[model samples]
Target chain A: MILEPHQIELIGYAAAFLTTFAFVPQAIVSWRTRDLSGVSLGMYSLFTFGVGLWLIYGLIIEKWPLILANAITFALALSILVLKLRYPRK
Target chain B: MILEPHQIELIGYAAAFLTTFAFVPQAIVSWRTRDLSGVSLGMYSLFTFGVGLWLIYGLIIEKWPLILANAITFALALSILVLKLRYPRK
Candidate 1:
């Protein structure tokens, strides 16, 4: 199936939006409850670092979807990572 | 700054590998502990769905990096989500 450039970009944006904002609930939950038992420090640590790299990669490639998504997702993931560190399991 | 196509793709793959595998620790932790206290259902629900969309988008766009990364990430995320549902916070 052939797709116009704009259509393809639109799809990319949609995908980016969903994936990026998906972390919001996680961040909010962690922040409010301060429960880090189920939250994996290793996962968030690596995920945040990876998202940062994705942001850089996006900048290098000049892809707005990649750049915007990773930028926001990085912040959210970092916040969760911080929470995990702050309130480790007792 | 000019980057060769291969170089650009290399960065994408690296980013993909990180973001995709970042879920490994989370899955393992959740699997072993079966604790969903800190794992938000809303987040996983949305994230798994989003990753599924990413997989579809990658297939449509024929982007191998997206396809490979999202496929693995989706599996990992879905597993976590299932674990979350199966073992809700006590």
Candidate 2:
């Protein structure tokens, strides 16, 4: 099926919004509970770094959706990573 | 700075690779430990759904990078979600 440019952009925006904010709940949970035992340190470490790279790539590509999404995601992921480090499994 | 298509593609690939595989460690950890105390159910549910949208978006755009990355990521994220649901915290 053929999609107009605006439709494509909308899909991109939706995808970006979903992926970016999906980390919010995790961040909130980690913050309030101060428990990261079930969280994987390695995953957060790699994921945060990956999100940073995604931000850089977005900038280079000059795509607002990518830039905005990755920027927010990076911050959220970073916070989770910090929480994981701050509270290790007992 | 101006970047050639190849350079831009390379960056996209790298970003895709990192973000996609970032879930591996978490999946492995969850599978082994079966302790999801630190994992947030809301986060996984939202994230898996988001990744599915990403896959659809990638297919519509016909972007190999997005398609490949999101496809693998969806699988990995789904696995983690299943594990999260299967083993909830006490």
Candidate 3:
């Protein structure tokens, strides 16, 4: 079965929301508690860069889901990265 | 500039690798260090199920990047979820 552009967009939105929100709690918890024990510095660094690339890719293709999701994810990931650097596990 | 199927696949692959690998360090660190202080239980549960949905969506769309990325991600996320439950932050 072929899907129309809107249908595809719907899938994209669903995917985007799910993936993006997944990181919210991580960011909030880290910020509130000032804990970085389970966070990997390397991972967040790579992830922040990766999400930025994804945002660019999304813009190139004009996919709203990709752009919006990556934009927010980038922020969240960056925040966690900052926290990780600020408070290293002792 | 219009992109061919192959070009689109390239973007997908790039996105998939970056996003998927982003979680690798998290999983490995959590496993090795057995630290869950920074991990959010609600986040992982939602993420695990969300990635599973993404995998299904990818399968339905016949997109290899989505399928492969989500497959690996699901496993990694699930592992983290299990760890979250097994070793809650004290």
lDDT of 3: 0.83
Regions of model 2 farther than 4 Å from truth? A1-5, B1-5
Evaluate model 2 with DockQ and give the value. Answer: 0.76
Give the TM-scores of the predictions, in the order they appear: 0.90, 0.90, 0.86
Which has the greatest DockQ? 2
**Ranking of models by DockQ:** 2, 1, 3
Off by over 4 Å in 1: A1-9, B1-8
Q: Which pairs of residues collide in model 1?
A: none
How is the predicted docking of candidate 2 categorized under the CAPRI scheme?
Answer: medium
Listed for every candidate in order, the interface RMSD values in angstroms are 1.3, 1.1, 2.0
Better of 1 and 2 by DockQ: 2
Q: What does candidate 1's lDDT look like per residue over B1-90, in tens digits?
A: 788989977876777788899999999999999988889999999888888888988998798878988999999999999999899984
Model 2 has an lDDT value of 0.87
CA lDDT of every candidate: 0.88, 0.87, 0.83
- Candidate 2 local lDDT, B1-90, one digit each (tens): 788999988877777778899899999988988988889999989899888988888898798878988999999899989988888884
Q: Each predicted complex: what DockQ?
A: 0.71, 0.76, 0.55
Best by lDDT: 1
Q: Estimate the lDDT of model 1.
A: 0.88
Chain A TM-score of candidate 2 vs. true chain A: 0.86
Q: Could you give the CAPRI-style class of model 1? A: medium
> Residue-wise lDDT of candidate 3 within A1-90, one digit each (tens)?
887878866775677688789889988898898888788887888788878878878887888867888899899889889999999873
Candidate 2: residue B46 lDDT (0-100): 89
